[model samples]
Target: MSNVLAIAGVTRILKDMLNDALVFGNVDQVMGTDFAVTAQPPDRIVSDNPDTQTPHLNLFLHRVTPNAALRNADLPTRSGDGALQMRPTLALDLHYILTAVAAEELHAEVLLGYAMQLFHEMPVVPRESIRTSLSAAELAGLGSGLPDFGTGPLSPAELADQIEMLKITPVALSMDDMSKMWTALQASYRTTVAYDVSVVLIERALPVRPTLPVLTRGGLRDPETGRDPGVAAEPHLATSVPSLLSVAAQDQHPVMRLGGRVVLTGTGLDTGDAQVRFREAGTDVSLLLVPEAPARPDRLVVQLPGPAALPGGSSLAGTPQDPASWRVGAYEIEVILTDSEARTAATNRLPLALAPAISATAVAGGLARR
Candidate 1:
């Protein structure tokens, strides 16, 4: 996976490659005008003034479409600081229109053909080439303002290091699409070829590492002795809360919509005067939104507010935008077993997914659009 500037870096690297591939490896030779190879949009490149006009090769990125198969691809790297950092990466297809603008018609055709020829011959961009050509700042990121990776001075070699060799392939554009392309750019049609650069990785900056805040206790009492030295052995769990294994029937799903029903599956759920409690994900407050459900020994069925009869004939479907809303994210669930004559005990946290569906019906013209 590459850093934030990998996309722009790929464009710069390509420009460099084509310039080097030109006859005698010269930069100011294409079409007698300055070989101005730019990645900017054609709309922004065009100007009304004739004095500043110059023939050039514009490798304009018309579109950036994400690769569906690797949409959620990530790198699980243990940071030097011991944080289990999940470095996220998005695979994308860079659609570039290699447009050649020249006063001489023949020169424009020659420039476009040469650009196509270069890519056809060197279809695969080598790691060594990208590593040697692109600087660390260009490969990792551009400016201090763009904190898209939150990483500190990543090396050039690490850019596009985890992904496959960047492949350049010609994309067939019909006459209609060609017309639309020129129309959208609001520029005159020029000799051009559409090419797709596969899998330029762009990583996000948000932190995804949060280590286990609490470990084993400092001292643990042995079964025979009252207490012992050193941290307690693993599985030194206190029975103050419950731990949930999963949700949905047979644990096949993890999400349930506001009006949908789901099964909260786990262990140690049985208790006197048993009732399941719901709390928002990232919050610790006394007030909770409890869903009406039939609490059982191993499972509890809950239906988000509708025609369901709750303990006190109360049900709720919190507002949509609020993360604490029943329509939003995961809700932490706990089973409370309190016997007035005996004692009261609550289990560990078990998150009840409020919205995202597991069968992914949500993605298939479902809530995925939302």
Candidate 2:
């Protein structure tokens, strides 16, 4: 996704493309003078002294609307618990009024015709052209660089690298529409053509909620009965802190791996804010992990830190998980529940055996038969 500079980047690319075409097409030789391409308001282009204004084309972004195809593509960006699931994007279609400014008769018409032809010939802006336009410090000798306009070098590659290639389409503006727009801008109506540059996506790289890998599907299968034992509910006997009945790896292995997930079956285990505690056996040092959403009162799923870093592993709480925090040993697992009153209570600790995952590269030699 692109950043906030995407809009300005698109405008810059269009202005530069037109300016280049004019230069290569040698419109100056045909018109017998210098021509300019600019990105400015229509009102700002016109002046009291008409003779001083040069024959030029001005790109003015008159309106911005959402792209109909991708407007709602990134919906449900956040989970029910208000955690960000994905980065939201703003897809936009830029409506521009390309106005030709020339006091002499037929000069504006010539410039407008040439600009329209250029847009028609080249419908889509090439990705490399976009990169070159945004990176350059100037456009068409008009000094219409990006917004900052020469403070320092800008990194607008995201705009160029966006998935949707910017396409130029002619917009047929009715006579009333043109009259209303020019009147609103308070500028004299010149030979103007409307165009739409579509699908400029702008999104920010915000941290999102990390999810766990799928362990077991459906439920644990009974060894003797060969039937899955789905989740069951048990009545809470009394009002007290949450208590754990059993702790097992979701994969049903004898020992849990560093990066594996564990399921805690207990009573009164769920709350709005629930964290699973993994304490090193016989030590006060421990780590707390927030459970995934869709809270359940009888079950809690928690992921254990891996032996090495994983994607977005540090984004859980903005703290990197150190491999030293977890090792091949016994850990006492418990669930901490926080109530609406801001009080917290932890459940009884249950034992879990965590083991180190062996790698083929780490082995000194191939295994030999005993």
Which candidate has the top score in TM-score?
A: 2
TM, every model: 0.47, 0.55
Off by over 4 Å in 2: 136-143, 147-154, 211-370
Q: Model 1 off-target regions past 4 Å?
A: 23-34, 46-53, 73-85, 136-157, 204-370
Global fold similarity of model 1 (TM-score): 0.47
Worst 10 residues of 1 by lDDT: 313-322
lDDT of 1 by residue, 90-181 (tens): 78888888887655556556666678889998899988888765654543453322233324564334554855779999989999999998
List RMSD in Å for every model shown: 19.2, 22.7
**Weakest lDDT window of 10 consecutive positions for candidate 2:** 311-320
Record all residue pairs in model 2 with backbone atoms less than 3 Å apart, i.e. clashing: none
**Global lDDT of each candidate:** 0.64, 0.80
In candidate 1, how many Å is residue 241 off? 44
Please count the clashing residue pairs in each candidate, in the order shown: 4, 0
Q: In candidate 1, residue 81 scores what lDDT?
A: 83
